[model samples]
Target: MKHQPINGQHHVSMLTKDAKQNLWFYTEVLGLRLVKKTVNQDDPSMYHLFYGNRNGAPGTEVSFFEMPNAGQTRKGTNSISSFSLLVPNDEALSYWASRLDSFEVPHEAIVSIGERKSLTFYDRDELTVHLVSAEKDNGIELVEPWITEDIPPKYVIVGLGPVELTVREASRTKAVLEDILGYTQVRTVPSMGDSKVMVDIYETGKGGLYTELQVKEVNDKDRERPGKGSIHHVAIRVKDVEELTEWAAKITAAGFENTGVIDRYYFHSLYFRDPNHILFEIATDGPGFEIDETFDALGENLTLPSFLEERREEIESKLHPIR
Candidate 1:
């Protein structure tokens, strides 16, 4: 197998109009633990909420940046399109379908995507989400689910699955994935009924649902007008800071301008945009969320990196309370 530096998706971040509502949908409705309650380091005026398993492990997180006045996202090409979460088995998919209905959350009937059955739905901000069964795949390791009284641990989302990237030209992004990032193009499949678009599957380390990146080639649509509910970027996991440095050099050698390595405090990160203008991040796995908060007290308090600690009072003054 060809060596790939990226393990799988670390986390997929999207835009949300309301942080409190976003918190409720993922924690109360979906049963993911609010692992980190912090502000976006780039823009400290707003919030960045992270949800994942009990530990907020790399592959399981789904995050959001609060954009208070942002409008609805306009769907089109050149976008991250949708993000999926893994369910333990087909039975879990069934449980989620009923759970979503009980909350009056509209969703599509479960349908087969490749060898796995997936149910599609939208969050409160209309961000596309899929609950895919991992029964047919044997590669990914399950993380400890955030235990909840109402939802069974078996049915809770285990980790993030294949992230769909819908772009005008797949070849451009394909070159970046395969040539620069060392990903292998695994297969191609028809999207759904009658659509001319073909979804190309690409895999990295350990090659399974969690490590796959699906690229949908669609030429008919316009470029996306990103706002609320639109994915900002998807972070790919690397083992540590040393490997991340190697990747920074590799990306630079490829002639693509990138944010060299950044100290995120929790995990170091390197950011770059693909040819389609879709932002991609390569992030380290260690020095995790527990660096600041204890495992049990993870997301309970407002946590800030050392540099931002000085401005905590001012930052808190600008933001609305979200709990």
Candidate 2:
């Protein structure tokens, strides 16, 4: 269709029962850099944690909002069921399996997902995460991984991969992806675990490993009851505020209710929900994690935007130290 402003994934936001544990798992165990230490703008009392590659690139990040004492997720349909992180190749998969075992983290053995190998695991909050290989992918943009003594550059996570959404019916969501969002239906696969469950693959932006979306259709299932460990939303990339504004108009004209452009300090965003009521955000790629903090000092301090700087003391008082 017309020039598609939507790029690949921006970041997937999830809920965590303990920010401290979440920080440990994502940074120490998973080897992602703690890109930003900030509070959720919507609720300054709770902390919002961001983890990503060295640059905190748009497609590489996954964020969390702390919700202390929130109960376990009641899994079912109509949810952003899982999100995958991109690893370099099959060798990286093998390395991650060993690393995870040493850390006493439970993960399934590596298996083929489409044309690539994937190792599925859960976080402290039981958030489903897949470490998918980009071995067969040629179109995914490369980025700098966060390397540490335990995790070398070769085995580090590069960026976000496909995100899966489970719903009772897929027709409406498919329409939104294809008709409104300009994503093309690439293929469908019977679930590796259950042949009866079919997954439709849709791709936007560059239309490769990093840009894929999988929607699993299950006709009979109750809606999910989200609490801790549940995904809050999945955001896709827009070039900037100018591109985001155009996307807002397109989404609005297509009759989908949306949050008209909001300045998130780091980036501008527009939010909307799919037919299954799964939250989706379109976010810009600039004014990123390095705006306030130096490249060397990111995630080292409790950072607030200019608007929230005045309330830093009050915000810090409410948050439990994530270190």
The best candidate by lDDT is 1
Clash pairs (backbone) in predicted model 2: none
Candidate 1 residue lDDT tens string, 118-236: 88898899988888899999887888878899998778789999899999889999999999898899988765321355788899888988898999988889999999999999999
Model 2 regions lying over 4 Å from their true place? 192-196
lDDT of each: 0.90, 0.88
lDDT score, residue 71, model 2? 98
Clashing pairs in 1: none
- What would the per-residue lDDT of candidate 2 be over residues 183-232, giving only the tens digit for each residue? 88888986533446778889887788778889998767799999998999
Which regions of candidate 1 fall more than 4 Å away from where they truly are? 1-4, 192-196
TM-score, prediction 1: 0.97
Worst 10 residues of 1 by lDDT: 189-198
